[model samples]
Target: MTTPHHNTAELAKLARVLDRQDPADLDFLATLPPAALRRFRDQITDLIAERESRRMQRIGAAAKLIPAPIAAKITEAAFGPVLAAAIAGSVDPARAVAIASALSPSFLADATVTLDPRRATALIAEVPDHMAAATARELIARGDYLTMGRLAGSVPDRVLRAALPHAADIDLLHVGYYLEDTDAADRLLAIVTDRVPGMLRATATENKWSEAITLLDLLGPTERSHLGNVVAHQDPEILDALLTAVTDLDAWDTLLPVAAGMEPSALQRLAERPIMQDPAVLTGIADLALTQNLWLDLLPLAQHLTPTQLHIVAARISAEPDDALTALIEQAHTANHWDTLIPVALALDEPARRRFAALPVMHRPDTLSAAVTTAATHNLWSAALPLVDVLPPHTHDLLATTIATLSTPDFHAALTAAPAAGSTTTLIRIVLRQDPTARAHSLTLLAESDDLESLVTSFATTDPEIWKSLAALNSELPPRLRTLLAAQAASCGHSDIAEALAT
Candidate 1:
């Protein structure tokens, strides 16, 4: 009942809306009355069907223009089993490709089965993008993977992009494994990513399609990074499946760089996955982190790991050669990634912790300060204390000075724990740099220690002004302790401390 002119006007308006429909406009379409929406969809479907019919008619009309002998040779002699063998041996592949372009996709798809696969690939390359896309869809429907894989890398981008919606996820995976053109592979994947979401992950896990992983190697860096982001956003279960597959296949060497490109939240999600809890997996990731200098990328994720997982990762990091560890530290420092290091430092065994703290990269004043601050922020004074012993004196003093500026609870906690950890001298020096209030707290803590005499002796020799500060808090000290401290200060030639204690 519709007039052609009205249908044309409506189709033009629909085209404009489809072209201009942003997310909000798309949502607006959802709000249309159900009848109207159905009518609109039906109209679009009719328009698409008409467009395709007209395109085929044009293609068929063009096929008529090809010399009748060539068309006859293609349809009769170039394809059927007996004639195919004769024509394939005699025809130039380029001419066959040209003749195939004007033919219908269904006829070409049937004919290609008889053509030598290598010649078919050559022929496909010269076919129009749309016809090639249609042929690919037909081939997929026929379960003709040999043909699909041969042509996959040769298909034009617009053709592959158009064909993807018609292909099955499993078929895509099968063909993806054999795709030869990296650019075509990347474009197909981009389309898959947009349309199928988790198909790659599902295909890899459920089907154990290890060959599909090779597609990653073919992707350019930009495409690989984009795929990494897409993979990163997959559900944890999908990620776990992917992790298991990659580990079983030993694909970390290829996958890690993509992982390293993920945003922090996505990386954190990956890090916290249960698959990462496996010791072997953790070790592999650590090796990648060190080799790729991805400490900055890996560290934040480290914080979300369970203590046991962290310990395993810390041990693996510790086992790296000293130079590798040093380089790792240097990269972390240059990237200002101390916050990521803090959790790992806390998880290391004492010897490993000390080793990490002693890395030459840890000697830089700013790096050292950042490390100490991160440790302090996490209340990891025990982990941080060992670093003081390995650091140069000035660096040690700097760390101590920074620790003294912590909140009262953190400061008091560090002071209380230092003696047991053998960092008392370091803590005392840090406290000495503080104003009177902190000095008073330090003096009270030192006076209460069982090793008060050793602390007093050390404080007297190291910084007499601290000894003077302690003596000024004389009333706060026990009477017997005050006598011992006065004798120690006088022996060290601190007359001011000796006179103050006597008062």
Candidate 2:
């Protein structure tokens, strides 16, 4: 028979018992007879200590399962070093896999693994297809041809000679990307030499851009040089993937040369790809090329960008304090593009903003004010406050009004403005009026008020709610304030106030 008891009801009852009985609440027992409260305090302290000990025991038990010192070193070593060391050393593959598996899978798939030659050859014959593919790539990364040839016998040719696979191809690139010997790249390229550009075109039709790059990387630079031409004359979808893959300028330079070598119509077709359509990416490409001092390569694509991109490029080139930042700020302002200029201004701080403010476009107070207010709005206080003087005439009042509208206006204003005696008093009164339940929180602010004596003396009647507010702010108030407030209320013959205000 199934159990019929209500598990949820039992748990709810247990939780209610716990919530109603906090250990700190036992502090009230201090008012009880001395012996009784002392015993109660001891029991509560013992219970809390025991529960804390159990939590620490569970934490220590879990910590033992991990090799802490070794685990800490994993992130510092790049994937290539870690994986190659795992394969080359006499360590167990299972242990190595455990460590390597924890690394980023994308980097792992792309990193080289160099196995001990004899072990590499033996594993290829003995291991299954999946294991053999991993070991063979690692063997190639070692740049040992005899080992690679012997290992290749059992492996699939498509995996070795044909297009490299995705996440699966990471290991292949890992080998090829780091190889020092020229012959290694030569031998690697030789495998893909027989296939013409037609192979990539065929692959692209199948929406196989991922595999095509793997194959292209394996080819020597000369063989892959016509890629821009092939891509230019090809379908647009193929061109998109090719462009997205060019993350840096060196890759762009290689591809751009191939693109320039192609027919003009082919280049136009390549330009039609979605990757080339976005202004940000186009500008990023131009900026990247300029960074590499490839100004000539960047010239052909200059007109393709929007004004915003050109401003970004200007900001990047004017990297030093001299002229680039001024040019960027000017370009961004003319384009009505504050988003682009704000980053450049903040990047330099007071000196940069000072320099930018000196420029003709920044001369208008409103523009500089808007920039500062924008920085403040985003809580970039350091940036905003430094530009405070550059703000327009009316912005300070607007900033004040905006700050006062905050839910916790006193706290927010305290953060924005430097503390002043009179200002702090006014802010505290404003916050106290807004808080509907003005007990502990507002009472703490009131205690901090510079006019503390005046605040207390004005409340002559000693209302119980006010007494409760003071008491809740700190329990010590009951004994100290009770005597003085009770004397005042009794002398005034305010019976209701005398009773509530008494300790």
Q: What is the TM-score of each candidate against the true structure?
A: 0.59, 0.27
- The worst-scoring run of ten residues by lDDT in candidate 1 lies at 1-10
Query: lDDT at 4 for candidate 2?
Result: 11
Off by over 4 Å in 1: 1-98, 101-130, 142-154, 198-205, 220-237, 287-300, 369-392, 397-428, 431-503
RMSD, candidate 2, Å? 31.0
Off by over 4 Å in 2: 1-198, 201-221, 245-266, 300-503
Estimate, for each residue in 194-295, the C-alpha lDDT of model 2 and write its tens digit.
Answer: 343445455544554443443344344554555545656555555665676653222564455444345556655655566666667655665655555444
Q: Report lDDT (Cα) of residue 202, candidate 2.
A: 56
Write model 1 residue lDDT over 164-219, tens digit each, in one string: 77777777776665454567677777767764455665574566436546666557
Clashes of each: 0, 7
